[model samples]
Target: MGLNVPTVSTGKKYTIEDYLKLDDGQSYELIEGELILVPRPRTKHQKIANRFFANLDRFVLMNNLGEVNGDVDVYLEEEVVAPDVFFVAKERLTIVGEMNIQGAPDLVVEVLSPSTARYDRKKKSRLYFRNGVKEYWLADPDQQLVEVLVAGEKEWKWIGVFDREDILTSNLLPGLEINLGEIFR
Candidate 1:
C-alpha cells in the first residue's frame, strides 16, 4: 500500500477592523491576530450561556454595576476582544471613542467551547491582564468550573478556581455574590 497524502490549508486573513465589520451571518472570533470562524454549537453550549447570563444580568442590575454586554466588541488599543460576557463598572463608563470600547473592563467572562478555549486561556488572558483588566473569568461549560483571574503587581494572579459547589465572589464588586451553579447548569 503506497498512498501519498496531501496537506490542505484554508482560512481568512483579516485585520481587527475587517473582522469586526464582518457581520456576514457567521459566528467568528479573533484569536492571536487571526479571525477564526466557528460553527454553531450543540444545544449544551446555548444552555450554559443562557444560565450564566440570566443570573449575571440580575446581579448587575441589583448592584448597579453598569451593564453586562454579550457579543459586544471591546477595544483595547491595538486589540479588539469580544468576551462571552463582559462587565464594565460605572467608574470606567467614560468611554467616548469612535468605534470601540475605550479601555479594559472591570470583568471579562469567557465561556469555553472547543473553538476558543486555548485562545481565551492563553492569548486573550495575557492581553487583558497586560492592559490592566481587573477580573477575568474563564467559564468551562463542559467541566462546569470557572477560573478567576485578577490583576496583580507583576501579572494577573490566580485568585481562585471555583466550581458549581462554590459561591463565586469578586473583590472588585465588594458585596456581589454569584452562584456558581447558575453558570454552567
Candidate 2:
C-alpha cells in the first residue's frame, strides 16, 4: 500500500507582511495567500455603503459600544479581508492594529455590486465565518434587500432577508436600527 501523505501547495502563498508591501492606491484582499483585486465600487454602490456607514457609525459612537469602520482590513492568520463596513466592540479594540485589525470584527458588511456578487456571497462569507465574525450582512443593491447571517456551531445561519419597507436591525448592536427605505434611497 502507498504511504498516506499531504501534498505540498504549488501556488504562491503570501503572508501579512507581503500584503503590507502592496501599493496603497488600490484595494485588494489576500485569500488563501493569493491576491485578489477588488473592483472600484460604482456611484450607487458607494452611496449604499456610505449611507449605512453613516447611520451605523453614529449609533455605535454615541452609544460608546464600538467603532465602525469603512473599507478597513480585518486580518486573519493567512488572509486579509476588507469588508465595506465592519464594527469592532470597544473591548475588542485591542485587535486594531496600525495598518489593520489583527483579528475578525464583530460584524462585517459587504455591499454587493454586479461584478463582485458571487465573490462576496460565497468566498467572503466563508472567510468571515471561518474567522469568527459574529455577524455578517450581505447588502444587495440590485435586489434592494439585505441578508443577515449569524455564526453558528457549523456555519453561518441566515436570520432573514429584509426589504426596503423593513427596518434593518442588527443582532450584534442590540438596539441599533436603520430604515432600509432611507438607505436604498
What do the candidate models score in CA lDDT, each in turn? 0.72, 0.86
Q: 49-163 in candidate 2: lDDT tens per residue? A: 9998999999998999988897878888788888899899999999988777889999988999877777788877898999899999999998999999999999999899999
- Summarize candidate 1's per-residue lDDT along 1-185 as a digit string, tens digits: 21111111246545677766776887665545556565565677667766667777788888888776666667776556666677777767775244557778778888877766776788788889888888998888778888998899888899888999898888977777777876656
Candidate 1 worst ten-residue window by lDDT = 1-10
Which number leads on lDDT?
Answer: 2
The number of residue pairs in model 1 that clash at the backbone is 0
Give RMSD to native, each candidate.
5.4, 6.3
